[model samples]
Target: MPTFTSNTAQINFQTFGDQSNPAIIFSNSLGTNYSMWQPQIEFFKSNYFIICYDTRGHGKSTAPQGPYNLELLGEDVINLLNHLEISKAIFCGISMGGITGQWLAQHYPDRFNYVIVCNTAAKIGSENTWLDRANLVREQGLLPIASTAAGRWFTDPFIQSNPTIVAKLSNDLGAGSPEGYASCCEALAKADVREDLSKIRIPVLIIAGQQDPVTTVEDGLYMQHNIPGSQLFEINASHISNLEKADDFNRAIQKFIV
Candidate 1:
């Protein structure tokens, strides 16, 4: 694993493929680290350079105080690119990560050549609802909701076939720092990009899980409708569709990027 330092926090990251190749950056979902993009990394590493980093307060990244919002988190990615001297890259983000990517595309369009957004919406849950969730995770450990969360994240077949993987991921989510999780929940709660979509001029691909309970296909359709010239692809899985339907998801992105 590699790491980088930004103004706010030190980020833990891992890279794959040749540095000279075009960069493909993948942002992980909430409560999970960059490892969530394992499937995509394996598939894309053979061609494009892949960048995976733990969002601040998740994985190995340091957890600061609460009250953080999308803009701050988005800047983390911007600073990471600046640190790497990456002038332009293709950005992909899922769930909470997708919100960050959308913000990045709107604020720093010059830094990204293309964008792939998955299982996310321009406006996430109501702020109060997310704040309540943050309070819940903070008071009680993530363990209490791990099973329910996993169920929403994966399809029934996926849960049945990949018990070990689901269990491990659940544990990982359970182990994340409560403050970090809460901060991100605030970010998600405050995120709304419906007005900003028109500003994105780069090629965009929107992927959705047909069965995703958290961010449904309707959300993908909303993005396609709003972002000019964006394409949409739906798969049969839940929130963590890319993991459950790794092959289909990776292939879709490969074709889109090429």
Candidate 2:
């Protein structure tokens, strides 16, 4: 694991597999950190160079002031790639991480070969809702929302059967600095990339969860419709489909990347 300073933030990240392999970057959902992509890391590491990082405010990465924006998050990844001397990569992300993938695809098209966006929308929730969450998390920490977020993340059956997995994810999520989480809340609040999706000319794969309350299947459809050559697939899970249906999730994208 290494830390890359991107502007004001020191991004914490881990790389897996051989450096000679083609690079592929994975971004986590808002609450969790790079460790969330462990399953993907283990699966893809042998064939593709895997780079996973903790977004600002989560994990061991630096969380700056509140009210963050998508540009900064996108730049953080770009800077990290620059630090490693990687010209471009394949990017995949879930939830808020998907939002970051969207930003990079549109604004820095030269930096990626393709993007896989999972369980995310061009514009997530309302600004007011994000503002409220930011205020609450800042005052009371991530514990309060962590419980509710768990429900959105895992289906009931998975939660009951995989208690240990649920508990560890919840811990990694709630462990982040409140200020960092709140700042990301602000970023989500202001992030509305619906109109600019036309700018993303690269190939795209949008993954959706049938039971995802956070971002519905329609959200994935919207992205698919907007991105010219984009494709869409759905799984029977919640927001964190990658975790609940790891094999299917990994299999769906293998065709495209391989």
> Against the true structure, what is each candidate's TM-score?
0.97, 0.98
lDDT of 2 by residue, 1-258 (tens): 589787688799999999999999999898899888888998999999999999987899988765789998888889988988999899999999998899888998998998999999999999999999999998999988887777989899999999998999988777778999999999999999998888789989999999999999999999999988899999999999999999999998788777
Predicted structure 2: lDDT: 0.90
RMSD of each: 1.1, 0.9
Q: What is the overall TM-score of model 2 with all chains considered together?
A: 0.98
Worst 10 residues of 1 by lDDT: 141-150
- Pairs in clash, predicted candidate 2: none
Span of 10 residues, lowest total lDDT, candidate 2: 1-10
Which candidate has the top score in TM-score? 2
Q: Candidate 1: list runs displaced more than 4 Å.
A: none
What is the lDDT for 114 in model 2?
Answer: 86
Query: In model 2, which runs have C-alpha deviations exceeding 4 angstroms?
Result: none
Best by lDDT: 2
